[model samples]
Target: MTRNVARNRSPFSIWLAVISLCTAGLVGTYVLFVEAPPPRRIVIATGGKDGAYYRFAQLYANLLKSEGITLEVRSTQGSVENLKLLMDDDSDVRVAFVQTGIANSEQCDSLEALASLYREPLWIFYRGSKGIDRLTQLKQQRIAIGPEGSGTRGIALQLLKANGLGEKDDEFSALAGNLAAEALERGEIDVAFFVAGVDAKYVRKLLRDPEIHLAELTHAEAYERQFRFLSAVKIDEGLLDLQQNIPSHQIVLIAPAATLVAHRSLHPALVSLLLKVATKVHQQGDLLSNVGEFPSPKLTDLPLNPEAERYFRSGPPVLQRFMPFWLASMLDRLKIMIIPLIMLLMPLMRVAPPLVRWQTRRKIYLWYAELRRIDLRSIDGMTIEEADSSLEHLHRLEQQIARIGVPLSYMEEYYNLRLHLNLVRSRVLSILRGEAGHSQPGSHPGFRTEGGESTLAR
Candidate 1:
């Protein structure tokens, strides 16, 4: 009885071991191949504290905080400095807002673009009465081209060089931002260059100042044709302050796109989250861009990241559409393991049932082989003592077979083996009754039928 109980428990134990091993293998696979969770904190290189880049970075910081990520905005001079920070190997800055044409493909091989946030128009505010309409007209006049390392200065030098101006000309000043605006108002400089968003306070203040005048780039399309990175935009009359009808006439402007760039190794989940934030913050229409025009894949100088491309083609990752941010991030990390795990299970699914079936029937087949051996021996002569011993052995085999546990699906085979056992037992009993005549101790026993043929004859 104890042996029977042990036999029944064997298969269950084997199956338990197999399942446990499979679970362990799957966990190991996940640990080895799946990506770790995204970092909880990241640093972004932004422009001056009061500039448009800094303001937008603050908004992104607030939005990311709700998703359990902390955004650290590091203040810098402008796009030129921001690009430098992103390229430095030891710097903590993972992302930055850079202006178009600041870094070319050769200079930014380690960077990729997420999206172009908006267009930054080059506003040339001057305090002059001679009606300066083109860049060439500012030849010998004192011009504030913004401080060094500022995007405003970079673009100003390029435009000034296109016209008949150079560094040798002593009239260029390094003033920028509010300082440039104050200098223009006080007549310290004849013209001041500003590359800022329409919503900047200083730009708005200068636009409404009666003493100041905004230069209309009458040849803006020509400039765009010359500089592929520049786009021709128009500031519609009175769009800045509709109530007071500021800028009473339409102003033609040429601008460069501002793109959000990151290191090539940045986490893909963070890229998706940043793209989502950019869409919310920059999708509204402004003086330089129509609604939904910004945060686009256009006007980028760097190669777009694959994750960002997927976001532009579809929306966020499919899992993120229905779940919270943290849960969705975990699931996204696990997605790479799903296919390999399914492949691992496929063969097991096909082979497990057959293995179990074989194990269940193995004991029954082993007993059947023993019964066949006893039947063959009974056909030959045996002493009476030996015949009684053989009968007892047959009874013992039957008791063993009866105790075995067979599942309902295999009952037919079980019953067939039992019938065969009974036939062998009857043959042994006939030998004991002298139905099979034994001539001598060493001779073979033969059983005669009604037709007088030997039953043991082949």
Candidate 2:
């Protein structure tokens, strides 16, 4: 009984396997053709650990960690070094915050901007009893333009050169950040230049100091025109500290926008994720920027990424609207494959059912053809011995059909074939009993012995 059951299921099992293999092949092909999954981890180059770039990068790392991505933040000297890490093909760095004008077209061919995050004002603090209104007045004084490879130094040199100072000038110093602030306070440097956010602790602390004065750029609009990336921004009176009136008056400043930049080949989904986090981090209004002014699609030194452009224009990808980050990312990767897989399977689905039906019917019909051959011999003049052999052949064909397994839909045909076999067997036996001459042609429902000819009745 067990053997019979196994035999009954054999054809279905074979066909099921065939269908399974075809499905597997399609899935494998899609996996091979689709884009590789986004990296599970990425590295970002930021400025010194105490600067705004490093602080904001840490915030991004926390946000990305919640989405199952590991964001490794590497602290560098500043924007100049950040650009170096991004441009190096051998480096693992994929993202960084770079200041505008720090990178030029020749240096940033392999990089793209996600968005401009915020404005970094160039603050020049001088210790003086008399006001210093221009870069030219401080040309001969010892000045801290930040350390080498820092964005502050890069922009300071540009501004200083416009006022006739250069590498030939022996009065330039290389102090930076807290060090630069300290040098000015201690009178080691007569002037200190800092490029940083208004909210930076050092900048706020220096603004409150009575001895140090924040020099206002009298020709801020001219500087903005000279350097297209620079914007003329104003520090309103009493905005920093209402009680102390830190600036004591409205101050005009020239600033460059800080941009979130990445390698040109960074994954599109990751680009979107970074942009989303940037908007959350920098959308608030500060002294220089109005609310929602940043994460702006403002063109910077690096060309804007196409994905970042689309995201700013239309919002997040459609799948990401309702799903969690990891699931949305997986679906976005797989979305390209959906249409191609559908194109492949539709025609197969249309033809598969009929092909199966024909296969099952053919199994039953083949034995009927054999039965017809034996029936024809009985009519075409077989003797008693030949009739006996034909009868035994018909019985063997019957046993074969009985053991064969087919779907229930084909059972009617199976039984009808068996009924025809029985009719032919009866006629063959009659011939063996010497009674073939008495039976009229066409008398049997399934067999036709007229003119000693056989017809396939199925």
RMSD of each: 6.9, 6.4
Please estimate how well model 2 matches the true structure, expressed as its whole-model Cα lDDT. 0.82
- Poorly placed runs, candidate 2 (over 4 Å): 1-25, 28-32, 383-385, 435-458
Residue lDDT tens for model 2, 123-217:
99999887988988886789898777889989999899889888787488889999889888888989999999888888999898889998887
Q: Please, what is the whole-model Cα lDDT of each candidate in the order they appear?
A: 0.83, 0.82
TM-score of each: 0.79, 0.89
Q: Which candidate tops TM-score? A: 2
Worst 10 residues of 1 by lDDT: 1-10
lDDT of 1 by residue, 1-458 (tens): 11242355435654775677668777997889888898889899988898989999999999999899999999989888888888999899999999887877798899999999999999998996778788889888899987777889889999999987987984899898899999899999989999988888889999889889989877899999888889988778898988989779788889998899999878999999999888889999576777988799888889998999999999888877788778999988888877867776677656667767777777567676677677778876666667667777777777777877878888888888899988987777777667345443324333335454345421
Q: Report lDDT (Cα) of residue 424, candidate 2.
A: 91
